[model samples]
Target: MAEWALIFKTAIALFAIVNPIGVIPIFISATDGWPAKDRAHTANTVAITVFIVLTVSALLGESILEFFSISIPSFQVGGGILVMLIAISMMHGKQSTTRQTPEEAQETAERNVIAVVPLSIPLLAGPGAISSMIITAQQSGSFWGHISLALPIAVVCLAIWLALRLSMHIAQRLGTIGINVVTRLMGLILAAMAVEFIAHGISGLFPSLAS
Candidate 1:
């Protein structure tokens, strides 16, 4: 039960950070000229890419950081800052430059194939989402925990797939203002999570100060 709860919380955090609703416009623009079947294929491809990227981050990201002699506390601080920057951008009703710059978005629209580039790579599974997963995996600390984390990662990917598959309807229903509202709310939640990450990192780095 506790494991499932953790998975649920992780899913919520990841979903908020990924915020496919915020990326709908970008996806729409990127797939503008494609037929419906092609658009669906793109959505499926992007979701699969997201799943692979985030699953790898959850399972192996910590080991990679350790291999480079990077400590988790330092990572937390840096990752938190990155997530905060994304949150701030969302608050301003814009996509984070860290994730996908306007130039990248423009370039994405001109690309022949975009599922792997802007959509899945940075837009859906960017630094913020990767960092969040790494931190969550670290907290889990067991084989079962890692397995549990994988479930939520899959759920997040599924949610992304559904959102992209229904992009037109969602965009029309939500409109620009509604999307902005959701973006702002998700940003607020992400900002709070970022602060928590920074706090935990600081406490770990300076135990004496914590006392």
Candidate 2:
């Protein structure tokens, strides 16, 4: 039961952070004028790319931290700050430069293949998302626990694909204001999660504070 609860929490956290609905406008614009088949293909490619990136992060992130002699607590704090910045940006209905800078966005515009570059890499599976998965992976502790993280990643990626596949209908139904409202709501949830991450990291770093 506890494991299931954790999985549910993981799903919610990933969904809030990824915020596929929030990215609908960007996806629509990027795939504009492409045939429906090509747009669908792009969405699938993005989903697969994100899933692979995040799953790898969840599996190998701890090792990478160890290689650098960085402790999980330190990573948690840093990742928390990054996530908080993204949350703040989402609240303002803007993409974080952390995810993709102006240059990257411009490059994405000029590029022919965007599914793997800006869309999948930074736009969706950005540093914040990667770090969050790493933190969660460390917390999971067991081999099975680490593997289970993939379930939520798959779910979030699926949501991303669906959102992109139906981008036009969603845009028509929700409009810009509606999308912004949802983004702000997701941002609020993400902010609370970020605080929790920071607090937990601090407690881990200073055991005395946990008492």
Top lDDT model: 2
In model 2, the Cα lDDT at residue 176 comes to: 92
- Tens digit of lDDT per residue, candidate 2, span 93-114? 9888899888877777787778
Query: In candidate 1, what residue range of length 10 has the lowest lDDT sum?
Result: 104-113
lDDT of 1 by residue, 55-154 (tens): 9998998999999999999898898899999989989988888987788877776776689998898888999999999988887889779867889988
How far out, in Å, is residue 113 in model 2? 2.0
* Model 2: residues with Cα > 4 Å off, grouped in runs: none
Per-candidate local distance difference test = 0.89, 0.93
> TM-score of the candidate numbered 1?
0.94
Model 2's alpha-carbon lDDT is: 0.93
**Residue runs of model 1 more than 4 Å from their true location after superposition:** 102-110
